[model samples]
Target: MTGATQRVADALRDAIEAGTYPPGGALPSSEDLAKAHGVAKVTAQKAVNQLAAEGYLTVVRRQPARVAEGPRRLSVVRDRKVYRDQIGYYFDQNAKPWGAIGTPTRGVATPPAHIADLLGTPRGRDVMTRTRLMAPKGSKVAHQVAISYIPVPVVAEVPAVGSSNTGPGGIYDRFEEHYGGPLEWRETVSARQSTSEEQTQLQIPANSSVLVVTREARIASGRTAVVVEVNETTMSAARFAVSYPIERDSSAGWSSTGGPRD
Candidate 1:
């Protein structure tokens, strides 16, 4: 990521963008790349690694790094609205294009610290987790990994959420149906370097970036909101982009900061 390494990476990226190396095409070896870029072999290798992490190239041991098949970038759009089917499948528009790689894997286990906190699970206690790996339908690349963690308290009330089959609408629908009505959702987004597992599943290289979306399912109480489930979604940052609408409001404009609302 230094000036020299980044300069080399930028040149290669420019070439890739320009079709100098078409998809699934092979790039020159590190030594050749170094000679072309007038950088050290190590610098060239770093550049290759850089582009690989950015989801451009695929690296293999003792082989030339090649362009990954498919468009260099995948634009994954995130929709804010949640939808439900009449038959009970609760989902969002963002998921319409993708399907699960397999049936959701479920288990009761101690969740990570952050997940535990989000689910309000007590330390040393376990939670029910339903995990699914989703990808664009018919695409070879994985799009995201979603894990939904439910507090034991909620699981106890609605045992279906703890099981592989949640009847019809899935966990969200079951939750709302059992709790009486609609459920509220809140999301917090952040970014981090891809984990080893994520890099393998997402087909990115080490140090690749991933976007993390942590969503909370809530129910309204008489005077407060209670969280029942936490869903964490991890997507390759190089391949996915979150989209949302911005509403125009004078009360939220810079004018509000300059003076009282007009």
Candidate 2:
């Protein structure tokens, strides 16, 4: 934010915090805000945009920017995901169950740059990808979208794995069979503004934030580990709480010196 925009934003934020403009309350129009703040209309708009991006305000065309209804409830707990020998890794579990919203899209395509890097493949290389939109069972509301990418070389070794229906156990089982090894999974989480396309697909607001989890599936090969697949999943930050339990390592114990023992 620019200096002028920051000033306007700070003032507006103070007013909101002071209950001058409570939650769900409307704020002045950009034109009025510009005049009041002695800043340009664009700067006032930028101020509103900044607050909207922070989830403090709701912005709609031809409407006065309003304070957000409330803080994120984050009611949905997203931690445990289920897996079975017959289906491999499947629908993620929470208090309420969710499933694929519709038929998944799958085909050969180039993986995203970071995904390709994780798969140890160069960008633009052909790979298989499956995209799925997921929502709670018996509901049409958007919950998450996942894209799973697999390298062509891995698929070539087990052609059936790339098929639309990978039979029982899905691709993970197939990959394990091909590698004669078990897969180890690791995930990294991040936060980012939802893209316009994601806003449409996920049915979220323009400035909504998303919790992004990128997971890599790797397997041991000889004395080295090889990344065979990577899956990227995104969910609305307002609706879901990402919770995970941390296990203490041996180094966590207190030492005679007072710090954790190594």
Candidate 3:
């Protein structure tokens, strides 16, 4: 949090993000950093220490700090098939970093303005909302956050979704069983500096950035089903990769349609 240290940390972080220091490569020591940045040793050390605390570096006694390996890559297939899988499978598999989603806080409440727009509901309209904080499984720092919003009508049809535990296959499965509707999904990815709250929740340092994935799930009938927001600190971006198997065209240059035979 120190100003001088943060400046130095920012420079080194840029270098790391730019791939100047490959994973597992050693970073300059505090003495070297101090000389390079014209700052005191303690200031340089804090810079390295802060990066380590933020999941960017590892500090071991008697050795220079080393760039840490990225967290497990979270790959989500962009298919519309019943997405009944719980998020635990994505972040908690092997339980290395995120072992389980902590107890969720859920209720009927008013969603944010943008989310309301996405849900096709009036602002301040009450809807079923669920918030979760993932639990760290090992020494890994907690770095992701998820929040979901669904219209009351849908929750009324599938009451289980209003509960903290949506049970096996999750809410989508419940929707399929109770509402008998096929769902479609779309996601938008963006990046920006982390907010103060995100910094605390994700344990990232000041000036750190995060990946914001705004997702919309709709029924085949063209009704907006639900909207979910997924957040991951930029420091963890190295560990995650997003792959969309887009189709190519002979004359059109690209195909806009998603489904088979479209």
Candidate 4:
């Protein structure tokens, strides 16, 4: 909000747009930026923080700030059945079918003990995890962050896990195809809040409520195939619309005037 902060933001924005600071590249330190822009160190720090809040940058402990990755392009579709079930808002990306578009990366820590219990797997067992940022088309800010987990055995079914495009049919579809059955059901829990790490990764404002959605999907054979956790914070105001069908009474016949018969 201050002049120094505005200058620092402008510099960072220009760096990103011009590729001076490429994606995944580290940003200069606050002290370095202040000297470079001839502004006070406090001003530079504020500017960096502002950019981080805007989702244009990310700051990791003891590491230089960096340009945050852009959101993945996703295709949105409408489904009547899903709409009726209050799951009408459908979004997907074709770049990766069963997994990520490149080599998968493992998280540093083992699966939390609670998650292991839920999945009936042992703690510290190797698992596959993938993360993605979601945003409205043409927007630089992310609206959601999704993380998915699968046991190593389930992930082995799809070797192309990290590079295949999961378009019309996503990973769930592929699971049915390979295993010859669909998921019997899935349970999801939602909440509102953001951790400091989430704030940095998502570029959300402090204290802003984020929609946290967690899901567990199971197949008929009792195998848990997918565990998804998503955190979404809207960059702007948006609305979700849904519609569905209701049962019709068959015993009632049409009247001569085309009205329902009594």
The candidate scoring highest on TM-score is 1
Report lDDT (Cα) of residue 158, candidate 2. Answer: 79
Clashes of 2: 0
Task: Give the winner by TM-score: 2 or 4.
Answer: 2
Cα error, candidate 4, residue 101 (Å): 13
Q: Over 4 Å off in model 3, which ranges?
A: 1-63, 66-98, 135-140, 220-246, 250-262
- Please provide, for model 1 over 1-262, each residue's C-alpha lDDT reduced to its tens digit, 9 standing for 90 to 100: 7788988897787566444686799999999999988889999999999999988999999988999885455544555666666655444565666778867798887887888887777876888888888876654456788888888888888888887778777887778778776788878889999889887676666787899989889886556777889998998776567777777566765564686555
Query: Which whole-number lDDT from 0 to 100 does residue 68 have in model 2?
Result: 93
Model 1 weakest lDDT span, ten residues long:
70-79
TM-scores for every predicted model: 0.66, 0.65, 0.56, 0.46
RMSD of 1: 10.8
- Judge candidate 4 against the unseen true structure and give its global Cα lDDT, from 0 to 1: 0.54
Query: Order the candidates by TM-score, highest first — what do you get?
Result: 1, 2, 3, 4
Better of 1 and 2 by TM-score: 1
lDDT for 148 (candidate 1): 88
Cα lDDT listed for each candidate = 0.78, 0.79, 0.64, 0.54
- Residue-level lDDT of model 3, residues 39-129, one tens digit each, is 9999999999988887889899999999987723455344333222334223223233454345667767777687788887889888877
Off by over 4 Å in 2: 1-68, 71-86, 90-92, 251-262
Q: Give the TM-score of candidate 4.
A: 0.46
* Per-residue accuracy of model 2 over 1-262 as CA lDDT, tens digit each: 7889988887886566434686798999999999999999999999999989878899999999999987443443335454553445653445335678879888888877888899999988989988888776654555788888888887787787678888777778888888899888888888899888777777676787889888898998789998878999887776666776565767677779988776
